[model samples]
Target chain A: MASGSARSCLEEAAALGSAPPVSYEESTMPPVDRSVVADLALFAGLGPAELDEVLREARSIRYPKDSAVFHQGAEADAFFVLLHGHLRVEKTTPQGQQIVVRYVSPGEIFGVAQALALKHYPATAVAAVDSIALCWPSAAWPRLTSKFPSLAANALQTVGSRLQDTQARVIEMSSEQVEQRVAHALLRLANQAGRKIETGVEIDFPISRQDVAEMTGTTLHTVSRILSAWEQRGLVEGGRQRIVLRDPHKLFALAEGRVPSERSGG
Target chain B: MASGSARSCLEEAAALGSAPPVSYEESTMPPVDRSVVADLALFAGLGPAELDEVLREARSIRYPKDSAVFHQGAEADAFFVLLHGHLRVEKTTPQGQQIVVRYVSPGEIFGVAQALALKHYPATAVAAVDSIALCWPSAAWPRLTSKFPSLAANALQTVGSRLQDTQARVIEMSSEQVEQRVAHALLRLANQAGRKIETGVEIDFPISRQDVAEMTGTTLHTVSRILSAWEQRGLVEGGRQRIVLRDPHKLFALAEGRVPSERSGG
Candidate 1:
């Protein structure tokens, strides 16, 4: 189903109608737009000249917070590299339970299904915040690969890392308790999306207790109770939609199958 | 951990300070020995010359039954496209239970972790039977992509389908009964690896009932009992080491959360 939209592109291409548009060098194309390529891991190490080349073939887009970049099962005609803000990858079960699969931050690439041989997206990706991204038509990957070997290597590394993360989630879901899952999820978010303050590491995103509950496969009541208990002991401090980790070591302990000491957050 | 092995390549590339390899048309390079462009759904319409250019850069290999093409935690340096025979992709739990995530057949690709961003294989892939496949060095994808736009489109479609399959499996594991899981697994295996014979369709691989038990998260005793019952009812015929599906429609009904007939296989 993810390929539904992309399929149209193929159908269009096959019927011998509208050929794909090709962009010329920077001098001929739109002004060198380094902002997009600068924030992408794939193009990180490239020189300005190389970045310009990549940008020549890419288009910049702005998405409002909560907008969908790609719906699960839609045709994927292009691959995206996040230039700003965050995106959430999610899937919904037949029972209608939404599982937040993972998050994509600035400098990361999404919609890699474009390079894998599938035409559809396996999950829906929504802008978690106001976002800017660079898009390369799926038609460009092969030409890009042949022209820039680093791009392919970068793509491989991206896919490999994602697979490891997914495998970790599967392992966690299969063996870890919901409490432990919550601890791990929070720790991960802090590591990836956390901002440091005088208090502790604060997750950059505006996640609620309910969001945490859903991520950990538990009810909101359980997450609230657990967080409240932790707050009473000073392990965390949460109020007005903010969470600060008071003790990362203790949280790590909980995530590693150990019993954590009481919270210190007040 | 999938990219752990590939890290060697990365380190080597870094040490050499050599530019990344790109392009599939270097006349100095060997002929296309392996290419997914032809078999891949996304690249279905490329001209013969484009296909040949891809083939020149590909390499083929054979894997014996029970051998692993890649191990979990290993570096993912290449993506594979299976040409013939069956392969089982699985993850091992801390408790040592083997979870057969999926089985792949000819024309399908695996080891795609190389493309996702992580460098490790999240699971192990073993040949369920003697198998032949083509391998594309992870380094080659970038150039291939830029040179042959359709390759990316094909890959994207493939990833989408795989994601859907994995999602379905995850849902079944969470909600389906063991019997239903077993039935579904059997049906899946039959579709991917079964061979039509005069009597019925036989699973192309040499899988034991115990293997099915593990795949279904059930006990061997349970699988044995169920198979015995199915045999008596003529829905299936179980031999010492093989099972033939006599009535796939009935099996499908069982897999769909329905009760099987008392007169089923033996």
Candidate 2:
């Protein structure tokens, strides 16, 4: 059943192709406040003048939900920092299957293929929600790095850790059972975007079971069934486009392939 | 049958744990030549004097095939650049399943956790073949970067590209069928380590079917069966710990889910 649903999901994804091209409109928006740039991890240690120089030619842009910020094969002209809302980094395979690679959180950088001197964006960046971002033209990368060397170092660190995380995800997909994979995927999402709710920690964005299925490389039916089972076991609470971890510790153990009895007794 | 074999492989990997602690024997090895550093992509633009400064405190070390260079979770005291032979970067999941993350080619840098200021190695590095490398103590990172700023920038670019590649692999694992995944994996390995042979391009290292299975998150039986079928089809030649792609174009088409008939007709 899981494989059948996964095939159908892939078919749907193939039909979807790419998200509709993003529509850009001129904005009367003021420049992003330097304070925000100073607070960003990328520019944390930059002096006031350094931050000013880095933002001198920067522009603020807004993208509506479900719109492409940039396409995978398009020229990489600018790099972005998410100021508000969410963005999804995705790659469409040669076979036309769309995969969610990762999500860009507030203050995080995206479209960094330019930083690596790549001519084209390796993946598409789509706005998961109505989003605002500070954009710097690719031409400014060298100047910014020269002035603030820490910026380059910080970016490397971010990229390194991200590589480690991606490899871990590959391991999970290859070695873990579907239930364990779902558990691990949820814990990761919670770490990235979880918010405290009255009952538990909620993923602070709209995400359907289909999205979870896509992220975990499983099927919507499988994810729905697992989440329903977890709900019955008092491990998680689920509703329309929302999931709250009622007991994160148990989920963590499950992700490690430990049964509840083994976890409790051991 | 495939799942059963995969389960047994996982059991064996769990028993293996981390590569037996890397036993470093004292050697009369000399410092790496400055010219070698000049040739590396990471140090491409460094002047001879700058290269010398970078290697001032470096040491050369050798590891026999299958020996550990560094274990996952161990303190990262140094960063390394492969001088000869290949290394495999692997990560063990919480469930004790080992996944081959990536292969390190000569002149490529590995064990870069220290460069990212990470306290422990995120993955284990094992010599896939008898290998030699230049190792630098982590304490010198700041001074080295301060002297040659390009070193840091170059490292960032390397890490960025690697992160993109890892994400691409994750997508393949998630969305591609096992046959497609295996084809893609073999193609990647060929590109990285291929050597012109009498009949075709051969992966220039000792890599078992079991290794390929681990790399693709499948089973030995599955990999063996696929290889045997490809062998019969004249697309590849498989032998003990060796594989030669007799027809790369067909394999490439298969990886993209194109049948030979469709590909030739189109």
Candidate 3:
């Protein structure tokens, strides 16, 4: 991924670290700390022994920023729980168009294709930042789930939220204006990974206009124009693959279809 | 639903047909035969005692066509497994625009907001036709899933498939042409509920052009225009809420973004 300049985006992402591949028994891999995962939603009710059992079959690895943990259509032989940092899940349409499906936060269990009866990954998962994850072989899915029904319940909860979120986006794409959709997308990212700053809440990651376009079913030019207008109005600060909501309440009002307040409160 | 012509669409949907509401303990509700659900994917390997235990907590109820099993934003106190007929899950956006999320076929579980950790249903579920479902109270969710881990696994599988389906639609909506999205939506419906006929496969349900528009994130006018063109081209037969695919293979090709072939095979 670091060296291939000519590779397609997904292909470039696929050639990187995922997890131990029958080669880590001799390596000096540090033991995972239980405290790191005990509070995760996926392991909500899991005890120390349960966490140990779950982690026993897992291997920890770090993926560099912009590298793919798994490419779309690759064999889905493993599932993962992110221990740190962020991830972006992207899907490429059959017609060679790439869409940013969603972003993954830490403590989330992802890439469980076998749970979906899928043999291949449906999307490419890229590390948004340098990220560490504990991955278990797909074969362990049934046994682990059977032994810990809470895992299945938690997974169900996770998938349910995603389905609802995706459907919400579809509704927006269908009925809302492009400006409102972009506003909503920004709000979602901010809600997920916002960091408080003197100006406002920053998305806490590097996200390009192109990524915003893919996420909102709009064009990069349109997103650029909208963001520029918002920037000019001092509603947001944007540049260098970074976005900060300077007036988040105003953005929220815009997202709700309220008229753009010409009276700047800030 | 049968009498209200002035009510909001979602409100109109909220007026009838969920499971027992503290009044059916003495009513003449028929017992749900175990044979009907024994082979369903949900209860894959439950023993007789487990089945009896689950059924004891469930209530079976029939909903008439055009009625709602539950409304969006209602307290999500119960979950359901459809035993007969089709259901349409629809979400009304904050802007009050209705979007058809997906259709539910027999043997599918729906409205498990408790599993998703939501206190209210995010979408309204309507009986696309006369349908029957076995519903369990939300309180039973944790207990039942814990007691029967396979139920949780199966539910995860179901939710996983839905999440994938919704994400696929998002990818299509983000990148595909309206015609392509419409084609994909139709193909999905046909795949899910198509019944083989002498000439071709029929959707086997009353699906209006408005429904198609909602499902594909388009307008009724647009859907009507597109369907009419396909009808004239001898690709499909549409009338009276019935859609028969006269040339499904051709339609499949169209959905896949292939150049529409003018040469008819039939």
TM-score of each predicted structure versus truth: 0.68, 0.85, 0.88
- Model 1 chain A lowest lDDT segment of ten: A1-10
Q: In candidate 2, list every pair of residues with a backbone clash.
A: none
Deviating ranges (above 4 Å) for candidate 1: A1-32, A56-61, A75-79, A112-121, A135-153, A213-244, A258-266, B1-64, B67-84, B93-97, B107-122, B130-164, B174-183, B197-200, B213-247, B250-266
Candidate 3: give the TM-score of chain A: 0.88
Each model's lDDT comes to 0.71, 0.79, 0.83
Q: What local lDDT score does residue B137 receive in model 3, on the 0 to 100 scale?
A: 79
- lDDT (tens digit, per residue) of candidate 1 on A1-266: 32222223234234323444533532355633685457567775678887777766666667777777888777878888888898877777655677677888888888877677668887788777788777777888877775766676666566656655655665676566777778889999889988998888998867778667656667779888888988887888897556899888888887887574444543
Residue B182, candidate 2: how far off, in angstroms? Answer: 1.4
lDDT of 2 by residue, A1-266 (tens): 01111112122233334536422321323345698777888887888886777776677677777777777887887788889888877778776777778888898987878778799999887777788888777777877876678888888877877887888888889998889989988998899888988888999888889888888888899999999989988999999989999899889988888784224575
On TM-score, the candidate that comes out on top is 3
In candidate 3, clashing pairs total 0
lDDT for model 3 comes to 0.83
- B1-266: candidate 3 lDDT, tens digit per residue: 34212233223123324434534633333345577888899999898778878877677777878888888888888888999999988888776778899999999999889999999999888888888888877889899988898888888888888888888888888888898898889889999999999878899789999999999988999999988999998889988899999888888888887765344653
DockQ of 3: 0.74
Q: Is candidate 2 or candidate 3 better by TM-score?
A: 3
When 1 and 2 are scored with TM-score, the better candidate is 2
**Model 1, span B21-49: residue lDDT tens:** 64454334553343544656645767777
Task: List the candidate 3 regions with Cα displacement exceeding 4 Å.
Answer: A1-30, A260-266, B1-30, B260-266
Candidate 3 CAPRI category: medium
Q: Rank the candidates by DockQ, best first.
A: 3, 2, 1
Q: In candidate 2, what are the lDDT values of residues B129-193, reduced to their tens digit?
A: 88888877777777787677788888888888888788888888888888888999999999999
